[model samples]
Target chain A: MNVTTGQSTDAARAIAAGRRSRRWGAWYVTEHRLRMMRTYTGTVVIAGIGSPLLYLYALGVGLATIVDANMGPDAVDGVSYLVFVAPALLATAAITVASEEFTYPIMLGYKWNPTFTGAAASPIRPVQIVDGVVYSVIIRMLVNLVLFYALMVLFGAAPSPVGFLGIVASLLGGLAFGTVIMGYTSTLQEDTGQLAMVQRFIVLPMSLFSGTFFPLAVFPIYLQWIGWISPLWHATELARVFSYGYAEPIWLTLVHVAYLVALIVIGWAWSRRIAVRRLNS
Target chain B: MPAPVIVARDLVKKYQDFAAVDGISFEVASGESFGLLGPNGAGKSTTMRMVGAVSTRTSGELGILGLDPDVHGPEIRSQLGVVPQSDNLDTELRVRENLLVYGRYFGLPRKLVAQRADELLAFAQLEGKEKARVDALSGGMKRRLTIARALINDPRILLLDEPTTGLDPQARHILWDRLFRLKEQGTTLLLTTHYMDEAEQLCDRLVVVDKGTIMAEGSPAELIRAHSTREVLEVRFGSDHNAEVGARLARAQGADGHRVEVLPDRVLIYSDNGEAELVKITEAGLRPVTSLVRRSSLEDVFLRLTGRSLVE
Candidate 1:
């Protein structure tokens, strides 16, 4: 009985230590997040919000006239071309923020400065370091998404109460992309143009082919696979299903959510291992 | 009596195929200022990393505060303060915020962190610059802030890895004084420095390491006396002269049967009495352009054993 109690006490001590380490790690992440926000908030607001707005004006207003005239009055769901593209724009903005927040910042934490080394030298453990970085990125993504969503409302792109659920979908999409890409970033050693390649070859292709600006039915059968696999496509489809009442099978929606959640779980486990190797080794 | 604050036996650390710290072992008694004195790439930093519980050793027994680093790294690290070779201060935060945030990493209460920051700032001589950003501070100021941040936990042992490497002479002196005060207050210090004078001035005992192994270990005076003569006579014989003076000086012997080393520019005559050696050099008909006698030091001891210049 005494031995069992001692073992339980040891387990309790370990639990307490783990909690303390996580608390320290959270503070470290908060400081990094706040510093990033203070320094880059203006840049993000301009690029994330302003760039999307400019793209919307230039593409929606300038090019819409010609496209609308060709496709006839009923071509765009009985709405303006601008309205048809607005929700897609919001989803795309969230994905862009996720890509930026996940890649270079994750690399910097692991390689450039190794802030984790200093933190781990304290009471914080390697796993907490990983958690802290992920938490900070999530917070940044949420803030950016909220701001973008607010701008969408201002532009009258939100069609119903269910339209607000698009922001949550966008967030889930961001987490899907961020987690998977962060795993890749943690394994990289050199500052190669690989991230740029991902942006150009992967993200751009997915964005252009995933029916963000048009319906997937308009695409060739071969190209339709892009929408089926793209997280942005899944998110935009879910958003449109909620916004315009486009019908999707319930199992299909579950598949979309499962795809994202599965990626997050797998990426999280891989990231934890990478953090331990990079730090303790 | 308290147990040894640090203990290592056959500790080895390898990076791929290269052994950075190859089976080195040593101990530091509590409250003693221990130094690892060596040239650049002599594995001093690697040894300190193992002791600080930041770098894992490949094989061997290691203990900090009587606990194994493999099992008790976080616990050991919490009780130890480390100042790395580089000033990795957060450039975005104010000087005081760096200390406060670092203290928070140790899970110290915010009020206690604030109080400790003030005390450490005063100790590091940066009390007035608390509000200034880290990037706005000078190199010396950044180094001082790093030191102050390290002390926030009031650790049982402090490890400094080449703390004065890039600082100017005046800045180095100030840092040395602060470290001396910490030593006086009975803080156990383990430092690595390539500067022999720094090791001599601050370390009560030190190990001279090279190629990841200890060459000698003792107090500075004791190591010098053990490996070198009491005094050394330096003779420079212009650029043109070489082996002729060397042959003559090699033939001449002092009362204690000491020898001389001849180089292209100078010849060092080792003996018990440097003045007597100077008389012998004159009598041997080798007129030198310059001559000086000085007491033997760790530099001389290192040169004798390594056959290489300390600074090079």
Candidate 2:
């Protein structure tokens, strides 16, 4: 074994680890997860850049022509169907990223690979680990949202001068959905394809029935309840208001903002509690 | 003990109705290599967790580095480095990155950690393999990397749980050498292993634990002197006749200290002069298929105290 010549005494370094922890612990953990994400950086970049382009090309040119030719180019909200649909696609992108980021990796951290236990042993708190995971995902989500918003402009889908504000609305929407899912994922001890089940049963249905491509009023009142409860619906409505100046009651717009923020708060707190219980046990 | 770094008294941990770690107490002083010797499910890991400040205790007291784990957990943990029983290296990261990232968790500076990671890689004898994928390394290399990762923060106390349990002899020796160097460098070591040879080789003092309680506590030689004879004569007879032979040996004239234990395949006779005692036993017409005399070991001490083998 080759050790360095200048070995500082152990006591000094040990005290340094403790002192630094109270200030920068969460950021360090965030730094670690981001490095883990870098292992598959190619996959994330390709999927982030490629998927949004495909969604826009398909819906903007192909589907917009059919809908506009029949509905006089203002079928919903006095905008082309593609323009109406772009924000929903971006919001769904966030959810897609959320589900992929939250489930199996969280399980891996806790059990399979148990990297979280390794983190738990350090001076950093388990709640910091939870914060770190969330921060890492938020970083990815923010990156994806910016790229998707750029593409939304390239496709001439976002027409309002302030269409860029949709990025913030979409990000908040994503967190509202992702954080809640993260809280649930952190509590899971067994996988058993449960995340896949959530993808198929909950996410797929929410995307289909949340009025992503059409006005929620088009659905019967009973089916509209799906739109009411779905975070996707809340996020999409907020993004629509920003993307194309889509008008609704002021109170209704406030409701959309309130709903997503509430879920983010609840889910973020739940995940922290779960991390404390599991890591400290 | 001089300037005891870790002090625990009547430490208890329970899960619902069952106590995983019942009232166990021990103290480890600065720079000492201490051990908890026990079989699987003996709660060695639980006690290590409590002392490591990763788990909360249900009752009793634990002071690590003069700080309480309940309130100063992060502070206590900062002074300790933990190598868990199993490797949890991030397969997503390269070999060197595992050390760097772990150092980051302790909130060390990136520049400091970078230099320390290289030094640790050298200390672990994997200097050129820094960029290798974690899964690409051999089990021995991975274990070494895990150990290196633990040292990234330059902790005062290093907590290892069965550090060499699954390694081959050569690999185990390599680890033992690395650990010996740490001990020489003034890093207090607290490890747990069921291998008596491991306890004897590494531990300056140890507690014999069974079912979450300490059965005995002392240095290896002291425990041996207290619980085992100076020599142990192992004699194997036909499987069907060993118990009967053991009974005869227990009462045989001029044989042993009169302490004999009958195992499934062999009989153990305890005496100060094993060779002479063996001669007396054979002369008494109690012959065996095979026999050997060896110095008493911690294994024998454990058997004497618990009426069971350490590994079984």
Top-scoring candidate (TM-score): 2
Q: DockQ for all models, in order? A: 0.33, 0.44
Which residue pairs of candidate 1 clash?
Answer: none
lDDT of 1 at B292: 94
* Model 1 chain A: worst 10 consecutive residues (lDDT sum): A1-10
Lowest summed lDDT across 10 adjacent residues in model 2 chain A is found at A1-10
For model 2, the docking class works out as acceptable
- For lDDT, the strongest prediction is 2
Q: Give every collision pair in model 2.
A: none
Badly placed stretches (over 4 Å) of model 2 are A1-16, B253-256
Could you tell me how far off, in angstroms, the CA of residue A113 lies in candidate 1 after the best superposition? Answer: 3.9
| lDDT digits (tens) for residues A102-196 of candidate 2 | 88899999999899999999988999998989899999888888989988898898999888888888788788888888899888889888889
Scored by TM against the true chain B, the candidates give 0.95, 0.97
Residue-pair clashes, model 1: 0
